[model samples]
Target: MLDVLVIGGGPAGSTAATLLARKGFSVRLLERDKFPRFQIGESLLPYNNDLFDRLGVSDELKRGEYFPKYGAHFVTGDGRTEFTFRFDRILPPEHQRSFQVRRSEFDHLLLRNAAASGVDVREETPVTSVRLENESCFVRVASGEEIEARFVIDGSGHASLLGSRTGKKSDIASLKKIAVFAHYRGVEKPKGRDAGNTTIVVIRDGWFWLIPVTGELMSVGLVVDRDHFVNCGLSAEELLERSIAATPFVAERMKSAGRVTQVYSRKDFSYRVRDLVGKRFALIGDAAGFLDPIFSTGVYMAMKSADIAADAVEARLRKGSMRGLERYERDMTRALGRYFHFISNFYRREFLEVFLQPSNRFGLLHAIVRILAGNVFGAAGDRLKLALFFVLVRIQKRRPVIARPIRWEALPRAASL
Candidate 1:
């Protein structure tokens, strides 16, 4: 019997298994797909640097050829606005700097590190069923192999392996955008102070992301209205070309870009499961919930959630008490809720205006980034920061206007026409 059975090999499962293995626990990680596979969400937040170091794989992560992103740059219809938030500006000098890596390489590196940490990794063996029979969990793999474990972790990305089997999945209704992304070579990267910055370009309809991963390679994606794609009688490739062309700044940069991969698309990228934990099983990463990728917070949330789940499982196995499991749910919900609220508010124009306003915006962003750099967890501080930011936005909108007396006479309307 395995101490813990993790049903995915992505960031969450791998992190959980690796951490548990380091604690001298027997961990079995089953991944349906093999490593070195193509994946998306290539950007990494500086906050993840600490987690990497904790796993003792910081040297390996640093060895990958990656672009060092300092902060994010935004472009609205008016013009470009750059926010240069260096990790060193808020984090310790040793923990400063994050990388924009190619997901294929990054995920494989993490999985290999997990194996190196003494995890029993099963690749190309998909999970078919999970059952709680006779007070024990049994996992059935695609090869008709049955593996019993004291606890199970559902990290099967959107498959929601354990969550679905236990009827714990529910969709969040607010998010309704579709995403189309592709990798390109020879794409122009930002220069000088703006080098390695992720650019978010907002057009009339929706937004686009430009993330540079290497010297000449970049990942470009569009999050647009689903209906718009349906109305336009163009293939995904054509739509991407037209959309990029319409956005002058992005179009000019991709003039000589050659496609490195086919266009990949997914609709309704946001949803949350009703429950994160049930009995002996727990959900992680997209299996728990998935917000859009606009903020590049997916991978960070995944590994963080895994860390929380690993702690819970370790306590349960060692002391035969489920008390730590409850804390896991609370922490996961609190951590995810903070990001969910912040991302949900990004769609509102008034919120955007207040968020861009210098005084309140910069101060609040600094505080939150500091918390992330410090790896603050298991509390309401994250949520508190989000609430403060939103309150400032509301105050800006509700400020009463002062009436001023007009001294000039009114002109005739017909003369103007």
Candidate 2:
């Protein structure tokens, strides 16, 4: 019997398996697909770099087509704004900038690192079923092979493998948005003032993400309202192109670009699993739930949750009890709660309008950005900062004098509305 059985070889699974194996646990990882696969969420925040270091896979990223990013740029209806809050800027001299990467190479590097650290890796192996018998978890492979383990981890991403089997999976209707995107080689990269910055172009119906990966290939995507797309009578690809063209900022950059790959659609991308854990089984990554990618926080959140799970599992193993899993569940809920609030807040233009007023000085806008980049949730100082910022904004808004058109360029510098 394996000490731990991890399903799905994505960032969360590999990280968990590697850490558990290093702690002397007999870990087995089952993956449905081979590595070098194409996946989205190309941008990386500084925290993800820390995760790579924890898994001892930092060097692999350095040798690839990676680009240093100091901050993000926003182009909204009002104007353009720039934010430069890289970890290197806030923390230490040794803390350099983060990198934008292609998931095909990035995910493969992570999973391979886990294998190198002695996790028994299984590729092209699909988990057929999971059964909790007695006190152990039995995982069956498609070939009728059975693997028994004291605990099982579901990192199956959106597949929600075990989660679907348990009938606890459900769609998050409020977040029913669809994404269509493609890679382009000749796409213009931000230069001079725009250099080293990722751009988020906000249009009427939705938003477009302009991520410049290495090798002159940029990842461009359109996230549109599901209802709008359904009513337009246009295919996802055509709708995406039309939306991108509608955004003057995005169109200015992508006008002459040629699509280097097929347009792909990620449908009904938001969801949540009612329960994140069972007797001897737990879910992580997209398996647990997924929110919109507006802030590009998906991978960071997944890896962070993995670290939390790894630590709890390690402690539980040492204590010879499964009680630590309770803490994991609690932490996961608290951690994702903040993001749920932030993303839900993002979809409402009326909520953002408060920030567009110059007299608004609650600093809620800035504080929320910082909190999103760091704590996510948990009652940390950043959370308090965000709260206070909101309080201040509400008080300031009570006065009619604090009303002014917030210019687009000033978006990054908005006080706290």
Q: Report RMSD (Å) for each prediction in the order shown.
A: 6.3, 4.6
lDDT of candidate 2 at residue 279, scale 0 to 100: 63
Question: Which candidate has the highest lDDT of all?
Answer: 1
- Local lDDT at 113 for model 1: 91
TM-score of each candidate structure, all chains considered together? 0.90, 0.89
Candidate 2's error at 202, in angstroms? 1.0
lDDT for each residue of candidate 2 in 13-74, tens digit (9 for 90 to 100)? 88888888988899999999988888998887765666778788778677777876666666
Please give the distance, in angstroms, between residue 260's alpha carbon in candidate 1 and its true position after superposition.
2.3
Q: Per-residue lDDT for 1-417 in model 1, tens only? A: 888899999999899999999999989999999888988888888878878899887787777687777666666533443344456665677656777899888888889999999999999999999887645699999989999998898999887877776677776677777788888998787676467878776665677888998877888888877767777677777777677776666777888998888999988777778778766788888888888776788888889889888888888888867777788887777767766766777765545555543343445776655544434464354556656767776665565121121111221100000
Clashes of 2: 7
**Residue pairs that clash (backbone atoms under 3 angstroms), model 2:** 78-408, 79-408, 80-408, 80-409, 363-415, 363-416, 364-416
